[model samples]
Target: MALRVAAELRRGQVVNLGIGLPTLVANYTPPDAGVIFHSENGILGYGPHAAEGEEDLDLINARGEHVTLPPGGAVVSHTDAFAMVRSGRLDVAVLGALQVSEKGDLANWMTPEKGIGSPGGALDMAAGAKRLIVITEHTNGGAPKVLKECSYPLTAAGRVDLIVTDLAVMEVTGDGLLLKEVAPGWSVESVRGLTGAPLRVSDGLKEMDFTLPQHPPVNKVYPSAAEAVADVPDGAVMLMDGFGGLGGMPHYLMLALRDQGAKGLTVVSNTVGIARVSGFGTPPSPDLQAVDHSILVERGQIRKAIATFPVSPSPSRPSAFERAYRRGEVELEVVSQGTLAERLRAGGSGVAAFYTPTGVGTVVAEGKEVREFNGRQHLLEEAIRGDFAFVRAHKADTLGNLVYRGTSRNFNLVMAAAAAVTIAEVDEIVEPGVLDPEAIVTPGIHVRRVVQRPAVFSPFQPIKPIEDNGRG
Candidate 1:
């Protein structure tokens, strides 16, 4: 029989689909479904399942499954990804449920036993989507999945809108579960009997209207490169991913935020740039002056900066810099970049802490708790979380799935997986499903939103272009 549920999806709809059963809809969508698929990691514009022999090793879905890219697909960072979701940009999010309440609450992430890997960003998406459709097996190990109320840990208070199961498709109403369509070969009595929850039906109940008109999306575009920065919020922390200017600092945004009087930013990066390594008037340029973010950071604009190398290397870069360190001008926390990144990753993913051997010796072991494993000392690294992460990307789709083009992929992907919101800047946007499944490094699941950004030419004036400077 034809799939009744697939008809519920309309074209041009941005849909956030949970793992497993909900993913099947990607395959069943009509060629003209006009549906814009979203993966939580930050990919939008998803296409059909991947074809054999054409898999791009870099591409994969939220579940780490291979997928096809649709036409006009793009990749974005976690910041932009979550921004879309949190901003109420998605049309629908189809989720798989462990238990659903009559009130429409859902519990699909953690179970008493180990099942799925992690909830990832399902909770965020569930709470953010304009519409939520649940698709799941009718029962689990003989027990009905539907219940009068969810017994499992709740992800959101009350957000479910519809429940589609093998036995029937139901909508949540204030009165209770509104039975809409009974699956083929199933009678209303059979479905009612199967459900463990209190079920209700409208006297005027009828099969749901599944057919929807396909709407074409208006093409969206963005400037090549634009950066905007704001101060870390009160009671919030700031984090960055880089081993110094080896990866360029966030020059444009930092300046913007600085100008906005944004203060109390706690800067965290791999290391201080050349100023820390080279003395001023040194024969070779430390490559630090070219670093925009670091320059602003050194100007007392940043309240705190953390890195593996705390001491400025030359101890002699700028006369004032040496005096500042001696006088405690820039607060610093030294750590190995590896450990720091892992800590941030763990923190962002909700992991409490991880054990590593990178910083167990010498001064690195000062105040932190330490333990020995396999006859070697290890230090406990706590996780780090941030309100927003400014990450770079080559391309992103509307769904928020991100793909990095080159060295720029480094800390951006890790940061994408570790923030409340990630704003991704990319050079290009492609149709969904065009990226080879094997090529996707970051799945769309961790991503919340995406915006197409054009290419940026650097060293431009910060102020709006006044009278033409002939450089244009």
Candidate 2:
């Protein structure tokens, strides 16, 4: 079945193969065919499944299954990967379908009454791919899958172009289901009996061919957070994940970075640091409850900062970053939150620059080119890339596939894709196949190293006020 679909692919085409059987197309692709496989988890030009005993825990497809990489392959951030799909750069998208209507409506994300379904990248791919092809069995337990109208929720309307089932090949068109071919042993009459929708047999109908090919695995586990960040060098641009306060901050990695003693670093993140409680000033305490990038700032390791918030909300007690900026000890480039996200996404995705209206007509627009679109002014912002990105996650597999617990997922998802190397600090490390494929938020391919979060870091501890002795 996979070979039949692989035969349809052309040379030099960029394609996205969805989870499940659709991923098998990579293995069957002809060696001479210059096809590029893209995984929504943020990889392109990935090779077939790993050979036995060669699985790299840090390398896998979008489905969280281990895979190898082809020459010249690249990894990108989540937003950038979606940008590729939504920008119509993908030549074809082969996805598994639960049901495809005669009118070309697709329903593959979820079944009715099964709670809210995770759409993942299916919605964007359905609407963005230049061509969409579906692969699935002709029927589910003897029930027809090609239907008059999908009973399941639509992934995208009128988007399916072709479908390859166990028993037949069909093309979707405005006129309706056009039966193009049937399996070798199946006849038109047999196919019609299994189809819920009316069929239009093609004049050139023929038998579907069947042939198969072989393909091939890795695990990413580090003993400690310090060892995970040991390779990071001085004067590197580092991206830290966290929104406000310490909700999603990678404190362990930040601590490792501080202890690693890298100097002249440029930090990129949403905020400089959490506000200092009354007694938490001057010589910072390792037990300081609000530690974040501010710890780096206080240590004088940061030579510059690019962020949305670099000061404490209360002006009376400035953050370490604020004091550094006022002293001309560090450079600062403040950006809008949305713009910052897009910039990091763009940087990871091969996009040099883009225009957005978020920062127009303000200091954010200073020294940037402004263009008018739809009668509104927009500023051009270059993409922001990092030498390394430190992120936090709830759980991770030995292969580095990550699952976030809550708001901690925030920038961590995008930062994983935006860096040259991404080191994840996870609370727990499970074996491969333990985390559900659908639940894996950051795929292993985007991560270079995985470290277990330290036990000493307690989330519920209260920060004591800084001793007001003259240190203030």
Candidate 3:
């Protein structure tokens, strides 16, 4: 729960940590995250828990737990710490809650059985912080902690923005508590069964993943794309993101994958690619090289492709995959674009099959199950998962969170989530927390490795303009 909330932290944000589980967020934050830890006890810029004998008497958090002070950290006066919270300098405040209401009311300070609890700065932080994240168990002693209304005294009304628990992660939205993601071993039905209030499920609801390192992840930065994808084996299911151009394709990674000679691969993508005439969605810039699926197809490394645009729009201009298919060297499974996107999303969300009304009574539905949905036939599309995914991003942090440029953010986002191991090729990689959390399209949890594109390399030659040697 703490790690999930920690992912919400952005660079240069001052976060106030309430007592208990909320305090553990400090331990999960990346060492170089650049987040300033604020405690009501007057410590600022504190580090993780202190090692046994290295504990400093003066360096303790609001909970009185021994902690470490990073360089440039300072001990402030009690007045100043509370002043920071009251003045709304804290970007986020994570508080422990006894109970939260559907209306976003908090009830952590006092309960009838618990009696009057220590009020302690929580009320002020809850009201003053830019955003509030509440961490707690989904239930307390067989009773739901998330209630239709808080029976206990309120800490702050309509202040909580998010709720993180062992069972589920929810957002306090206008409709109600919106179920975002559920923990592993939990089902929506089971979570709803335990909640005191009605829950509104999000369309993008997925499993709350914990694949990231438990304690501040080890630096996953690799030196180059070659080393990053060196271990990719034969007969792998590879996911490549692009729209027949350079906008979002993992050019360097695909080059490395080709050089690595990992053959007999099945590829999932939006297009099989027209390499010779492809650019960043422009009219094939001569200065830009298109190192997309065509490279892998030309190398004969791809055994098959699952794509929407498997062939070029013009029959005269055949893609490499199309030519290969003509020669019986490659296979194709055509799907509608929307179904393809949903199929990848289902793979990441652990759904085996979903019904869609696309391709009915057509060749696309030839071998699939057909069902009736509201008097319309829907085909059952099985989810597509990948052994490896090669994705491109404009920038990446050491932790592997990514920010894409322009239409480059297309299939890359869903492909990253659907793959077993995702390798990202980026132009720049910064230290953790260097990026705005909102700008990150692909979280580091889904990315296994980060490799920087070579600083100096020309993949395409500039085409010379044709001179008018004859009359038009």
Best by TM-score: 1
Clashes of each: 69, 16, 0
Ranked candidates, highest lDDT first:
3, 2, 1
Q: Per-residue alpha-carbon lDDT of model 2 for 117-182, expressed as tens digits?
A: 889889888997889999999999999999999989899999999999999999998899899889
User: What is the lDDT for 183 in model 1?
Assistant: 69
Report the lDDT tens digits of candidate 3 across residue range 1-472: 9888888787656799888889888877886776778888876667888999998887788899998865535555576566556544577999999999988899999888877678888998898788999999999998999999999999999999999998999999987999999998899999999999999999999999554343343556899888999889989999986765556788788877767777799999888876554434333464654566777787778899998988877788787789999999998998899999989877764567899998898899987999998999999999888988888888988767788898887898778767878898888988755776435666564677999988874444243232332311
Q: What TM-score goes with each of the models?
A: 0.60, 0.56, 0.55
Superior by lDDT: candidate 2 or candidate 3: 3
TM-score ranking from best candidate downward: 1, 2, 3
Off by over 4 Å in 1: 1-24, 27-46, 49-68, 71-145, 148-162, 166-194, 199-236, 273-289, 298-300, 318-330, 348-350, 361-372, 392-408, 425-472
lDDT value for model 1:
0.64
- Segments in model 3 whose C-alpha atoms lie over 4 Å from true places: 1-217, 277-289, 457-472
Name the 10 consecutive residues with the lowest summed lDDT in model 3. Answer: 463-472
lDDT of 1 by residue, 123-171 (tens): 8888888898888888888788888878788877679898888878888
